[model samples]
Target: MFTIATWNINSIRLRAGLVTRLLTEEAPDILCLQECKSPVDRMPLQLFADMGYRWAVARGQRGYNGVAILSRLPIEDAGDRDHAALGHARHVAARLPGGVVVHNLYVPAGGDTPDRTVNEKFGQKLDFLTDMRDAFRAEPPRRSILVGDLNIAPREDDVWSHRQLLKVVSHTPVEVAHLSDAMQAGDWVDITRQDIPTGPLFSWWSYRNRDWTLSDRGRRLDHIWASRDIAAAGHASRILRPVRGWDQPSDHVPVLASFDLPV
Candidate 1:
């Protein structure tokens, strides 16, 4: 069995120690991290490699919109795409030894306003999803896994209060529709949802909440998706919610999926 995990670290440099703690504990075969907020060269590669994650493919900017896939298993850099013509380092892909491709992405967190007309960031987010849909429609993925902080909470149960967040940037109807279209385009299966389809699941909590667990205001922003061909192999999906309570924690937590496939 192979275990893979996805997390939006928010800032890799600042939380490299936390990542080390996770690697020491969970020890997933592969870990996809988003919002690295550092150049690829500036990442703590030595630290992770020392812990046995010697292979990686990363796309990163100086201080924002970055992603990386770190693996203990052998893998090759499969490159990335500049979705929506946004030159940010928001995507990176890698191929595992047995030909499974893994994509790590950090979707834009639109500004406060839900209206594209009033919020340029919101329009960019929509455009990014549109580009993703078009790309997948043009070349459908097979035997692949996609994970990231997709930003939007597509399901009503994905958030603490869907009604209250309807007009919010991440839970807006337009954003949900766009994200859904992207999913349909690739025929991707939501691994986390498939594992636990009936409950209120979440991977992100607000730092604004003084007592986040007590308030329980969270959203299922991070996601793990697999192509239909290999989706059935996916099992034991879970969100590491307690990680959010870690020291100097990020607003997001790790989401994990285990697959009954060879390395």
Candidate 2:
């Protein structure tokens, strides 16, 4: 069995030690990271390699959006696409043994406004999801897993207060619909939701909250998805919420899925 995890580290360089701690503790076979906020060459990759995550593929920029995959297993960079023509370093893919592909992505935050007419970032977010849907429609995925801080919390149960957040950028109906279309296009199964079908689930808590755990006002922004054939092999899905309490932690936590498949 192999386990894979995803986290929006916010800025890898600023919190490299936290990542090392996670590696030492949970030890997922593959870890997908978003918002690395550093150039690929500047990433502290040697430290990861020393911890046994010897293989990796990353797309990074100076100090903004970035996505990377660190692996203990043998893998090759399968390449990436610039969805929505945003020109951000937000997507990366890696091919593992037996033809399995993993995609790490960081979707736009869409700003504070939910209305696309007044908010260009919101429009870009929708366009990104649309482009993803079209791409999957063109060539559907197989034996694939996609993970990242997708930004939107699609379900009512995904947020602490869905009714209040209906007009919020990430929880708005339009964003949810866009996300659903992307999932349907690729026939992706939400591994976490598939395992825990009910209750309020969250992976991100706002840093603005002085006592985030006490307030518990969080959203399930990070996600793990699997193609039809591979979805059945996935189990033991969980969100490491306690990680959010770590010193100088990212607002987001890690989500993991254990697969009963060969490496």
Candidate 3:
């Protein structure tokens, strides 16, 4: 029973205590975090180690776009790729003891405008997805799991009001197609959706909403995907929404899954 969790922590240095609480409480064997917003050297690794997460692989930038994987299990740094040539530390991979490669990614949130023509950020987002698809197709993933704040909710049910959000950046048709293409290209299974196949599941809510839970205008922007070969072992998918109510919590909550790795 190997459990892993992913969260868009927003900032690691500021939220180190929150992470510590999660580590001591939920205690997933491994936790992948996104948007660390701290340089690699500055991450609160020692603090996490004190909480029993003694190993980690991370790629980070000064004030934005970073990813890290903290593990109780022994793991090795596998490479970090700067998808879309945006030069952001948005990805990191680690090889677990059983040769299962875990990829932690932070996809770019295309700006408020969905149009690539006017929004360079939006164009970069689309380009990033294309590169991901191409890379996966080039070297198919075997025993792998990819998880992160993908930033796009690819299903109608993934958003609170899909109809209203069709033009919204995260729930737009173009973005959904790109995410689906990437998923199909990698032969990945949506483990979260597979486990809880029917529902309005969400992991992100806007801070704009004063009463986020009451409004419930959320989106399933984060995701956990497993390669088909090891997907059958994936289960126990869940979202830690309550964490959003934590003191100074991130806009995005944690998403978790368990894999029945053979002994």
User: How many clashes (backbone N, Cα, C below 3 Å) per candidate?
Assistant: 0, 0, 0
Assess candidate 1 and give its TM-score to the true structure.
Answer: 0.99
Expressed as tens digits, the lDDT of each residue in 1-263 for candidate 3 is 69999999999999998999999889999999999999999999988888788999999999998999999999999998889899999999999988999999999999999999899999999999999999999999999999999999998889999889999999899999999999999999999999999989999999999999899999999999999999999999999999999999999999999999942
Q: Tell me how far the alpha carbon of residue 36 in candidate 3 is from the true structure, in angstroms, after superposition.
A: 0.2
Shift of residue 257 alpha carbon in model 3, Å: 0.4
1-263: candidate 1 lDDT, tens digit per residue:
79999999999999999999999999999999999999999999889999999998898899788899999999999989999998989999999888999999899999888888988998899999999999999999998999999998999999999999998888989899999999999999999999999879999998999999999999999999999999999999989999999999999999999998877
Candidate 2, 1-263: lDDT as tens digits: 78999999999999999999999999999999999999999999999999999999999999899999999999999999999899999999999897899999999999998888998998999999999999999989999999999999999999999899999889999999999999999999999999999999999999999999999999999999999998999999999999999999999999999988777
TM-score against native, each model: 0.99, 0.99, 0.99
Candidate 3, run of 10 with poorest lDDT: 254-263
lDDT value, residue 136 of candidate 2: 91
Tell me which residue pairs clash in candidate 1. none
Which regions in candidate 2 have their CA more than 4 angstroms from the true location? Answer: none
lDDT of 1: 0.94
